[model samples]
Each structure stands twice: as structure tokens, then as C-alpha cells.
Target: MANWVRISSRSIGNHIRKRMNQGFIGSAVDINKSSGSSSALHGGRTVCDRNRRYLNSLPWNRATLFWFQRFKSTVAEKQQDSFLSSDTDDDQLSLDFPGGKVSYTSDMNFISESSQTRVPCYRVLDDDGELIKDTDFQQVSKEAAVKMYSKMVNLQIMDTIFYEAQRQGRISFYLTSAGEEAINIASAAALTEQDIILPQYREPGVLLWRGFTLQEFADQCFGNKADYGKGRQMPIHYGSKKHNFFTISSPIATQLPQAAGIAYSLKMDNKKACVVSYIGDGGTSEGDFHAGLNFAAVMEAPVIFFCRNNGWAISTNVWEQFRSDGIVVKGRAYGIRSIRVDGNDALAVYTAVSAAREMAVNEQRPILIEALTYRVGHHSTSDDSTKYRQSDEIVYWKNARNPVNRFRNWVQSNGWWSDQQETQLRSSVRKQVIISLIGLDIHNLHFFSDT
Candidate 1:
């Protein structure tokens, strides 16, 4: 009787076939030419060479061997032709497989660092707040533009006052969307009232834009009797069912999968709306991010994964987070359409999100947007960003790339906003925030004792 090794061709063939399909048409074993060990042998025979010969000598089906050899030669010849033929369309040089069509490449090269080949950020305005020549963006009417700017200003002032209150020990904790005001307000402006918003802690601007009043925000933050959460949740974990905005949570990336489910629910009900889920660059590192994106893609859910890549996750810098080309590329891995945008450019963010929402709803597919911005403030009241990063870096983003100032510049260039109007808007917003805080303190004082 012959000694027999039960070879599972199903598994082995699948593995080798997958490798071959990926453009690996070379020899199975490589000779160590650099070490001058090409001829080196163990027990008078090279290990790989001996194993190959032994495998070939097995009593296998002749037809199976012939088929594999033919397949290998055919793929190798086609790959060579593709490389040598200048007239061949690059798009045509692809291998159709179970997953998808993979483009063929002759060079065995690993992808370089993301920094060397970073995705270009989409921008409508320069750092000086002037529109880029021939820039394509969704045009905003003066009224709508003014409203967007006012909401942005309102959000900025609210963040400033709330952060100060936290510092003064009036609030237990707070998260300010200081440099990220545009990302919040602009994205909110692009969505309809029917759209669902699943926000991280930094997206109170969405609530404000959706008509959550200053008094409401103050109530929630102060956790007064008028607070929707009734003091059960922490400050800044705001939610308004009336506005279709889900409650904010402290757990990182937990909202991602929830967004997918909500979008799928909307799809099932045949609603003409999509879900917008927001996250920080640091949140993308969570396993929930992958699960959420995969779930949305697999379900063909109408959802937009909005990533605020502000270059930090608390103390962790983005470089230390991942090696990929930021958060946008992760969308591609999950088969979701993605784009990178200038988070500081309000028009750019609004335009990108407007188009993204349309595509997501019409095509019933997931979209990922990475808004590249900087966090000018500390991560939260508990964090001191200066401990981890330079103050000059913060100052540069705060002064040069200030989103509120940039949008104000655009509106002023159009003769729609003036210094007088700016002064009035700032004063009025500050007064509203201050009044709301004062009212909340008085209400809490009486309400706390009664409760």
C-alpha cells in the first residue's frame, strides 16, 4: 500500500488561485540569490525544491495538473502582454475574481506611506478666505448664506461660553467645537429636517441649526428640570427627538453601527431621507467603525459617515492612529464612496455633504466624508492640548484657517455682510448665551431643591 497524504485541493487550490488572481504570476518558490544559497541543500536537497518534487510525484489527476499549468501560463502571458503593450488601456488590465476586478500591476511594489501619496483635500476657498478660481460648489443664496454664517457664529459663541462655564466649575464637563464650527453648521445646513443625525459629542451645532434654542442647549448642559435627559446624561450629550437628532454619547464610534441601522430602517420604510453619522479621526480606529461601515455597505443603507479628521484623538496624534491615507480611504475598503474636504471651508463642506446626501439617498449606498481640520482648543475641559502639541500650531489654525472668519470673508466679498453686522451678530449671540446661562442657573437653583 502507498503512504497517502490527504491533500485538500479545495483549500490549497483556492489559496493559490487567489494569489494568482492578485497578479502574483511568478514562480512559487524564490531562490535566495543575495545569500548565494540558490544551490544550498538540506540533506543534499533544497527544502522547497524537495517539497515541490515530492508533491509533483504524488499520484494526482493528470488533468488537474494540466489545468493548473495552463492557467498559470495563460495568466503570466497576459500579464506580460499588458506590461509590454503600450496601446493597452490601463482600465482593461484587470483580473475578474470573486471579490471584484483588480487592476494588474507588473511591478511588485508595496504602497508607500500615506503622507507621500495623501489624498488631495477638496477646497473652495484659499487660506486667505478668497474663492479659488473656477471652483465648483453648490451656490448659496444670500439669505441662506447669511443664515448659515449666523448659525456658525451662534455655535462658536455658544461653545466659548459653555467652555468657560466648565472652566468656572459651573458645569461638570464640556466639549467645545471651536475650530470645527463650520463642519457642524455647514453639514447641518446641507441636510433636510427629515434626515436623521447620529452625532458624536462635538456636534451641538447640528442641534442649533435644527432649531434647538439657546435656552434648550443651556438647559441640557446645566441638566436642569427643563433638560430633556432630566439630569441622567452628562453635559453636552444632547439629543432632541423633535429634531430627529439622536442623543450624543461619550463612547467612541458607538454611533456608527447605530447610524447604519437607522438608515436601513429609513430605507425599509421607503422614506426620502438618509442618515448622517459623525465621528472624529480617532474614532475611526475603533472596531465599531469597521463594523458600522461594513454593515452599511452590505445592507446598501443610505447613510453618510462624516469623519472630522482634526489631527488628534485627545492626546493621540493622527500619525500614531493609523498608516492609511486618513479616514477617507477606509470608506473605500468598505466599498463606500468617499471624499476628503477642507473642513474649514464652509462652502466646500456644505457642497460636498449636499452631493453626498443626494447620492446616498438616490443610490441607496453609503458615503464617507473626511473633513480635514484642526482642533484649536483642548480635546475637552479635561484635556490640555498644549501638553501634547505646540501652541504655534494651534494659533495658526485658529487665526489663519478660522472657519467663521473665512465664511465671513466670503459673505463680505459679496457685500452681504459688514463690520457693523458682524459686531451686532456677535453681541446678540453672546447676550443670548449669557442670558440662557443665567436663566438656567436660576431655574436649577429652585428646581434642584424641589426635586
Candidate 2:
């Protein structure tokens, strides 16, 4: 016997190939049974002290050490009994290291069931906002639905005004979230304020959901003194420590690795939160994307690599971006759970990310989500999408397949909202945007310029 417990039914066979699952991470549980609490061990040394020394002795950093500390704190008495009695997949092993060999199970199996068949994208709401037949509809409360809708509408208003502002030479740059706003707001609604968000520049809806005001957005975009980054960052490269969102970096796929490190820290402290990193389809080409996901998988960091595959990675379509089927397949390569969601369907995105977050935080593991949607507007204020893509394609998405309209339809059908409410909401948001745009830095309005 190897004195180990291999938890069964994993999509990937054994996250730890030999050592940790055998008796490394699970070692604390063995000691936990004999002497409870933070009491002393056989050498009259405190359990915490011994644990720290033991972890430090291994090839683990302070982050891994902290993960053990936090896990040790939360291990329940029932868990101890289950560990003591269970014989689920205990097996001996053999390993060749730099110095010697250890006894272990030579047989290994990968659960191909997860990836063998075609994994369908999860969808709860249709374009008409009607629930699909047999949809285990993840119900959003009236209050939550309203809040999410408000945020989505807010994103729309901000995008329209900001895009116009850029055209009018009021600002140097702007990026409209457009069709992806539902994905942004709904996902944020599913998460707590404490969960760190590493977003692309287009995900201002997440910030708004976390109480990042329109005025703050204005200040940042204008590079005014009131901006939190002190005018150092470019427009839309917003960050708010108070909101728990990392500053948006322009470099593709950089945030994914940073998110991995952040999640590892959270695990070390045993916080009930996960990091969600957003990236575009083209970003998958970056080496950091692979490095970040692979590192998170191996280290068992609690993070979510959210791929906002809006059909294009700034003019390069998804077909040209990757050879694989989609971003979800990449998760299987990384040896973790993943999902493909209907990015235009707010309910679907919310459900998928919520479940992913639960698994990430509770299991201290990583999950990837590939959101299948389209970028309905220009890549930014600089690039003209019309030059590369067809006008009909644009009309199809913006008119017939608008996510905000789809969600609004669902809300109306459920009696959560009405035509009057929708009208009033739109009117209010437009007025509010106008007010915020005009009221911002009124005394120093001249300070804003294309320069």
C-alpha cells in the first residue's frame, strides 16, 4: 500500500502523477486525526510550526505553504474519518527521480469520457429570450435580473457615448464592449465583490457591477488628475484595487499568468474566492496563455481562464486564430474541467461561471470557460471592423442577435420587466450618461483633449 487516497471520477487522471496524492497534500489529514487543533506534535513542536517546516522542506513556495495552512484550518472531523476508512483508489507507485526510485502504481488511466464525445455549448436563453425546451434554467432572482439588466444597459450607453466622444475628438481612444456586455455583466453578477477580475479593456461592465461609477470611467478615459492611475494608463486601461479588479493590461494573455499567481495567493490564505481572467480569441496565440493555464493546472491554483471568443481577435477570425475546435478543448490539454457557454445568453454565462467558481474555490483547482459570441463593433476606435468584415454580418449580430435585447426579452416574458420599464430604463440611462459626460470635470472641461 502506498498510504494514499486517490479521489476518483476526475476528468483528468490524477493531477499529481505520483507524489502529492500518494501522501504529500494528503499528509496533513493523517496528522490531523491524532492530535486535533493547533496543538504540539511528538517533538513538543506546534503543529503549525511542523507543518510550515515540512512544507518549506518540500519544493514549495510560501504560496503553497499557505495553501496547506489554510486547508489544515478548514479540515473537518468527518473528513478525517472518511479519509481513514476510504479505499477508493489506493495503490503503490514507482518513480524515478534524480537520486532514487519509489514504489507506486505503474498503471494509469485518463478519463476520456469528458472529451471523447462532443461537448456542447451550454445555452439557456434563445434570441427571443425564450427558454429552450428541457433547459435546467438557472433562475435569476428578480432583483439580480434587474441589476444585471441595468448594468448591461449601462455598458450600452457608455459605449455609445464614448464611441461618439472619440469620433468627436473628445477623447483619444475608446473601446465599446457592444454585444459582449451581457457576458460581462452576468458573469460579474454571479461573483462576489472579493473575487479578483483580470479583464480585457472591453469588460467595463464588470467594473460597473462592482460599483465603478461612470464618472470614474470618464476620469480614467480623460487621463484627468481624478483618475486612480494618475493619468499613467491609457483610456479604458482601468484598474480599481477597491473593486478587486486588476488593472487592464494592453499586452495580450499577460493577465492570465498574473491571475494564476493571484489565485495561488488566495488559496494560500484559504479565501473563498477565485480569479477570473478574460482574454480574446487571438490571445490564445500568446505563449503566456499556455504558460498561465498549465502552471495553474499543475500548481492547483483556483482561477478561471475566461476566453471571450467574440469570433474575432481584432480582425483575425476564430477560424484563423486556432487549429483546435475551440478554447474549451485547451482545458482538456491543461488537465482540468472546462465548459463552453453561449456568450450571448446572459443566463448561460452566469450559470457556467457560477459553477466554475464553486469548483475552483472549493477544490482549489482551475477551470476554463470558452464563451462563444461575436464582437459586434469595431475592435476599437482605431480599427474599422467594416474594412475586414461584411456589413450583413454586422447587421445580423447587432439587430437580430443582440444579447442585451435577448436578456430583456427573457425578463419581460418572466414579468420581471415591462415595455414601459424598458423604455424608462433606456431613457434614464441615456440622460444619466449625458449628465455624467457633461458634469465630469466641469470646472476643467478644457483639460480633456485628443492629446
Candidate 3:
């Protein structure tokens, strides 16, 4: 509503008028008068034109107009900055002044920037096969090694069976943690039966190790009459309250905070149970990751944050996704103790997770374990990995670090397992899976319908 008049030359004004025509100034003045009322202002629609003509009426002095124009712009900028920026600092600007003089100085130089940098990963196995030992490495017993090998083999077979079921059109979708079997099986084997396991989308091997029957898995996958979840969730979103395995969420990293809350309740009740929640490297980018970590640390929640740093989250590699460091170092920011392990090595995963679980239970604090693994399959049955990834990478991983083969060789070398026993176990499990598939009513909607 305030008017701003500036000095300009009469000749320049005359030239502008010549271009605009004779009645322009009069029309502008009329518009300015009508601007006070809504009806007149809407009919005329010439407030901008009136202001230009009024400015043209003044004397043409460059210095005065330039300084005055700058002053007006400065005031407008200050108001905008005040509205837009969070006014947390005390010395920003105090508009409480006599006669309302714009008292602003460029205080941008005084603002402080956070100097924190990412911490590096603490690891047992380096990129090469060399070992980096610390007090953290707990030696696995021979018995534990045998158990680990057996579970890994069973898991591999189970994954293949599920994939075949999906291909046979018995299920809508299936995700096998094909290459990352060591991480899934070994970590679950290390935990107590009472301890809670909250898995992300790909860790079905953990549930299998936790005593989930083949028929139970088949029911859920096929959404059959016996499915516990009533076929409400997708195939891989598994849950078993009896086993203390929390349900899987499609939204990445949401379970992190929920796990922290569960841990807090366990702490309050003075219970021995600790929550072990799994997530991928992609989930780290989410705000929930930071919120969960911070909350767990602040509350001393007995939660183990397991990050499967699987080199790729559906083709977005860790290098493209994060610059700070691997997911392990993220724990340092929240004061939670963390470690990185060779997720391919079953022994290494079991050892690291054993120590992490001890810390969570005995120390009454949260722990983070970043397991470096690879997803051998496409992200899911719905995905096509060949589109975004190189064929050589998959071949290399498949040949070099197949989890089942690695653990199998280790067990065979020690005479813990024999070829005969291995063949018998595989044949028995395969027969069981085939038998379960026969009764699997894939098309029956009774499980999901009305329940």
C-alpha cells in the first residue's frame, strides 16, 4: 500500500510517454485512485502500470534512485530471510528499534558449521582373506561350527525350493537370501530361543533356523488354509509370535525404531530378551535409521541393529548411496557399539553376532553389526538384476564365496560332516518340500478371504 517515488530525467520520461501514448499518465493516476477499492481495482487491473508512471514523473538522478532501490530490496530480503530461516540464533536481527530504521549488518560470517566426520569400520576380515583380530572375536566351538554348516545347507535348499514354487506359479512372489545364507543362518543360530528376531525382507533363513516347519512356510507362501497370517501379507513378510520373530514391514527401516521400543520394554521388565533387527544398506538413508539409533542409545535399549551391507540395494551400490563410510561407522554417531564382519564367512558371522548378543544382554546396551554380504538373486522375483548389474559380478560372487560350499568345505576338512550324511539330509529335505507343495492350494482364497 506504501508508495515509492524515485528521481528520473524529464527527457527519459517524455520518451517513455511517447512509446506508451498521450493518455498513459492520466490512466495510471486513475488506476492508482481506484486501487483503494476492491471493485475498482479488479475492473482497472493497472496498479503496476500506475506505479511505473509515478516513478517516471520524478527527476532522473542515477545515484539517489540506485541507493533508494537497493534500500527497499534490502528490507524485502531481510523480511524474507526472517520468514524462511529458523530463527534459532540470538544475534540474527532485532527489529525492536526506535522510528523503525532498518538496522541490519551481514552476520552470515558468524554462523558455525558442524565439524563432525564419519568414523571408520572395525572389521574382523579385511577385503582380502587376512584376519584382523580383536578382543571382540570369540572363538566358535567345533559343535557350533557343525551346527552352522548344517543350517546353511538346509537354508540353501529351502531357498531353492521356494524359488521353484514361485516359478511353478504356486506363489505370487518369492525372495531368496541365496548368497547371504551365512549371515541369516549363523546369526540366528547364535541367539537364544527367547531372544526376539526382527527381520527385513530377505532373511527367511533365520525363520527356518528358528524351527519354522516346511508346511508353515508353504502355507504362508501359498496363502493356503493353514497360513497363520491369514494370507493378509505378501509371501516373504513372515511372522511367528510363538518363536518371537517379529513381522516384516515393506517400508524399509521402520522396524528399527519398533525394535528399539521392544528392547526398552525388555530393559524395563529386567528380562533377558534382546531384539535383533535386520535391515539393508539402503535403509540407512532413511530418517528412521537415525531416529531409532538415537532413541536406542539414549534409552540403553537392548537392541542389536544388524545392517546387511550387501554391496547393492537393488542395484544402487554402496559407493553411489553413501560417501561417509560403510554402514558400520554409522553406529559411532549415536554412541552405539558396532562391528563389521565378513558376511560370507559363517564362522565370522557367528563369532561377531555372539559377542554382539553378549554385549546387548549383559552390558544392557544397543549394538550394531554391519554384515558385508551380496544378494545372489535379483532383488526379488519381480526384479531383473541383469538390467542394472553386470553379469561378471554375479558369476564372480557365485564361484568364489558361495556360503554353502565355504562352510561345507570347512566342515568336511574337519570330518564334522560326511558326503553320505549331506546327501541324505538334502534328499530328505527335498522330499519334504515336494510333498508339502502337493497339498499347497495356491489358488484357494479361503485363507485371505473374510479373515
Candidate 3, pairs of clashing residues: 7-59, 8-58, 8-59, 8-60, 9-60
lDDT for each candidate structure: 0.82, 0.79, 0.73
Q: Rank the candidates by lDDT, best first.
A: 1, 2, 3
Q: 324-410, model 2: which lDDT tens digit per residue?
A: 778888887877689999999999999998898888888788999999999998999999999889999999999899999999988
Query: What lDDT score is found at residue 437 in candidate 1?
Result: 78
- Clash counts per candidate, in order, are 0, 7, 5
Which candidate comes out best when scored by lDDT? 1
Q: Model 3, range 233-306, lDDT digits (tens) per residue?
A: 88988899988998887998999999998897777556987999999999999999999999988778889999
RMSD of each: 16.1, 10.0, 20.6
In model 3, how many backbone clashes occur? Answer: 5
- lDDT of model 1, residue 368: 96
Tens-place lDDT per residue, model 1, 231-310, is 99999999999999999888999999999988977775569999999999999989999999999887788899999999
